[model samples]
Target chain A: MTRFANPKKFYNLSQKLIPILGITTLLFFAIGLYFALFHSPADYQQGESVRMMYIHVPAAWFSTLIFVFMATMSGVAFVWRHPLADLLAQEAALIGAIYTSIALITGSLWGKLAWGAYWVWDARLTSVLILLFLYIAYLALKQSMQDKPIASKMLRLLALIGLLNIPIIKGSVQWWTTLHQPPSIIRSLGISIHMSMLIPLLLMAAAFGLFFLTILLMRTQTRLLNIKTIALLKKQDQLDDPSLAA
Target chain B: MHIFSALLKHEFLLLTRNKEIFFTLLLFFGLSLFLFPFALSSDATLLKSFGPGLLWVITIFTILSSVESFYKKDNDNSLLSFYYIQKTPFILVFFTKIIAHFCLMISILMIILPLFGLFFGLELKSIVILSASLLLGTPPLITLIHFAIALTLSTQKTGMLVLVIVLPFIIPILIFGVGTVTFYETGQTLKQPFMFMAAIFLFVFAFVPWIAAYALKESARQ
Candidate 1:
């Protein structure tokens, strides 16, 4: 694992793994969509629109998962002074925010169908909006700094502070009366599990997780290349004038 | 301790020297409170109901304008370097500055609350409860504003940047704060909102200072 911390090793590994992640992502989504949209029975109450759950729930789950990943990468950047970790965190935050946005929009669409209003100032909704703001602020602050190291540390500090909101967001539903639809997917085992619906949802979730890793490694590889390019350029300039090269 | 007090003194002196800004913010607070009657429905009932929130919003902004003095005063002095060498506990600096802010906010509130009461036709009894809530609430106000200000200390426009950053975190405080005065005015018992604000105050007091202290330490190293 430590050896893979080398950008060269990571880059080589990513090159090998992308085709696998790519093919599997395509296969999983295609199969999942087929099973989800066609094979699964419509909800007795929600009718056809309940099909939105397969996408909405997994995306929401992925959004939270991505934030945790971003936070962990932020922690790594702070503790070990890892330059790559900093970049990984920045990218993940943007991606996580996009995921969250999709979740909220889709949730709203579903809410309009289910609740008769497009928006409600509920505990769950307010907390998600707050989470989105935290992501935007983190990204904005990170970009605003001109000093790389200072930006890294400042953003990491911001991320850590912002993390306090995450648990609040997660628990908001439990703590407050809200208009949001409660957990639809994570039911207990004895509750007549439908293997048909469950398999596709789980597959989609796994696919998105692998998809995140694939893109993260690809971005990391590009960043490593950019660093190498700058280093090469500097060395070339030195070679052009040996007297000052030392 | 000496360095922090010195920094605190420097911050206060800087704030005092810019009496125009200090006065402008205070005036903004005053005028903003005046808008309460006009902005809300002119029905005395509706106006009375929402009056406390406008006053609290004004108070928060007045505090925000002054809190930036902590970062801005470092412009000529390089006090962060001075404190770095002095090895001051960052939280001590944080608390001292927040204390100064609380003093300013409270002074502004003291001067204005009665004015808000008289002009807006506020119920006197509820005003008293509202004042009690403000007294309990303002420590956390200073504390969180300092935390937010420190975190965004390096933003190009620190004032607006922090306003954007902290709005969500401040909402819970706003809910309890405004709820206290509004509920009290509605002839209901004010116990719950008061307790809620107190709890929020304690939470921010304990949490925000530590975050601010850490951010200040990080900013100093730069």
Candidate 2:
């Protein structure tokens, strides 16, 4: 991990891994969609609307997962002053925000079918909405700063503070008598979901995870290249007028 | 310790000199409270029920507006860098500033809120509960706003940016703050929500100054 903290090394390594991750993500989606749409049994209570879970659940999982990832990278960037960590975190913010939006929209759609309301002030839904706002805040803060290094530093602190929402979002359903359902798949004792649903759900989660990684690498690479271009342009300006270097 | 007291005195002096913030906050609070009745029905029972939530919303907007100006003069003059150069403990300065701001704003709020409550036809008991919850809840909310301002000090537009960033984080405080009053009205023990609000205040009180100080330093560096 420390070795990849170097941008050059990360760039080289990610170049090779991106193709593999992309292909695996495609493969997972193909298999997961097949099972999700055709193979899995209809939920006795929810009927056809239960099918929304395949996409909604995975998107929700990735939303939280990407935030945790960004926060971790933020910590790494702060502690180690790793440029790659900062880049990864910056790239992850938008992806996380997109996934969070996906989760909210799909969850609302699912709610319309399952709970007979388009929205509810349920703890789970409210907290997820807050999560989306946090992501937007992170992105806006990132964009507002003119200084790159300073922005990174402040954003690192913001990310760490924002991480408090993750646990709250997770525990919201249990903490309050929410209309949103409680966690059924991952628990302390064992999986509560049936194997039929669990398999595709897990597969779809993997697909989303890989998709996040692939896009993250691609975005980070572009950012790094942009940084290098700016550096080169500054150097050229310095060369053109040596007095400007002072 | 002397430096801290001096800082507190200096902050209070500055705050007193800047009466515009206080007046703006008062007018904003009054107008928002006034608008609520016009926007919603003016039925006494309905207004009484809506009192706590309306007051909390006004409190949030006031905090956001007031705290945005707390660091304005310093940031404008780049005085923050001077503090760093002198090795002044920013955490102490920030805490003093926040305390001063809280004392001024919350006192003004306490005075005006009861009148708003009277206008809304809230019972004396509910008014007392609302004031107490505001007292407990406002510190953490101000601390959070202070943190948001510190974080976005480098940005051009701090007001809406601070709101967008800070509102979500403050929801829990708002929840428990409003919850305390609601619970009281419902004849439930206010202990739970009151304690929760106090706990949030304590937590933010202990740690947010350090974070805000760090952000101040970072933004100052820029």
Candidate 3:
């Protein structure tokens, strides 16, 4: 991991991994979708509407999971000054935001079918909404700062602050929800899902995880190339005029 | 101790000299309260029910707006470096600044809140609970804002960025603030949300100054 902290090594390594990761991602999606749509049995109570769980649950899981990953990378970037850590975090946040959107949309659709409303201020739903906002905040903060060193440090601090807030947000939302609404009978997961449903859910989650990795690697590579191009241009300009060095 | 007291006195003096921020904040708070009825239904019961949430929304926005100016004068004049040169702790200065700002802002809001409450048809009891809730909630909210402003000090546009970053983090305070009023109105014990808000205040108070100081140092370096 430390060896890959060098941008050159990371770029070289990711170049080889991207194709393999991309292929596996596609393969997993193909298989996961097949099982999710066709092979899995209809939920006993929810029936066909339960199928949305495959996409929705996985997206929700990865959305939160990616944030945790970004926060860790941010800590690494801040503490160790890992060369690719900030870049990885920046790319992961975009992917996490996309996943969060997917989760919210799919969850809304599922809610409309299951809970009779497209939106509710329910704990789970509201917390996911907040998660999406956190991602947007991260992106906005990154964009607002012009100085790279300062921006990275501040972004890391924001990420850490965000990390501390997530559990508090989740806990408070849960407490608020339970105070208002009766306990939901259909536990989204945990002792509710059967073996048949669990397979596709896990598979879809794995596929989504793979997809996140592939996109993150691609985006990080593009960022590295961008930096390289700018450096090369600056070098050429300096070579063209000796006075430019001063 | 002397430095901290002097810093507090300095911030208060500056606040007194530049009275525009005080008036602008008060005006914005009053205008937001006044506009609520116009935008929504003017019916008394409706306004009463909406009062706590409206007040909180206004309070959050007021804090955000006021915090933008908190560091602007210092940043523009490069006055923050003076503390470094004087060998004063940045955290002490940052905390003193936020405390002074919080006291001033919350006092102004509290003074004007009764009239806004009467205008919105809130009962005397509700107004008291609302004030209590704000008292418990505002410290943490202000600390969070201070930290956010520090983090965004190096940014080109700090206003919206700070709002975007700080809003979600502050939602729990909003929830509890509004909840405290609702609970009081419903004849439920106010202990729960009040305690929750107080907890948040204490938590942020304990740690946010250090974070803000660290961010201040980093921004100054840039």
TM-score of each: 0.86, 0.94, 0.94
TM-score of chain A of each: 0.85, 0.90, 0.94
| Model 2 / residue B14 / CA error / Å | 1.4
The docking quality of candidate 2, as DockQ, is 0.60
Candidate 2 local lDDT, B1-222, one digit each (tens) = 998999998898988898887887888888889888889999988988888888898888888877867788888887888888888888987888889988887778867877887799978888888889988888888888999999998888888889988967788777777777778887888787777677777877777789899898777776
Provide the DockQ value for model 1: 0.41
Model 1 Cα lDDT, one tens digit per residue, B1-222? 566667678657866776777577678888887776766667877677667877888777777776776678673367776776778888887877877677777777888889888877787887897798889878877777777777766555777767766765676666667767766655667777777777777767767788688888877776
Interface RMSD over true interface Cα atoms for each candidate:
2.6, 2.1, 1.0
What DockQ, on C-alphas, does every prediction get? 0.41, 0.60, 0.74
lDDT of 1 at B156: 56
DockQ ranking of the models: 3, 2, 1
CA deviation > 4 Å runs, candidate 1: A169-196, A231-246, B182-196
lDDT for A116 (candidate 2)? 72
* Alpha-carbon lDDT of model 3: 0.86
Question: What tens-digit string does per-residue lDDT give for candidate 2 at A165-245?
Answer: 456334433334322244432232133789999999999999898899999999999898889999999999999999999
- Over A1-246, each residue of candidate 1 has an lDDT whose tens digit, in order, gives 557766677779889998888888888888888888998988776789977877887888888787778888888877887777777887788777887898899989988887777776666666777778878877677666654456676677677657765764445333333222444432221245467778878877877777777777777778778878988998998899887687
The C-alpha lDDT values of all candidates are 0.74, 0.83, 0.86
TM-score of 1: 0.86
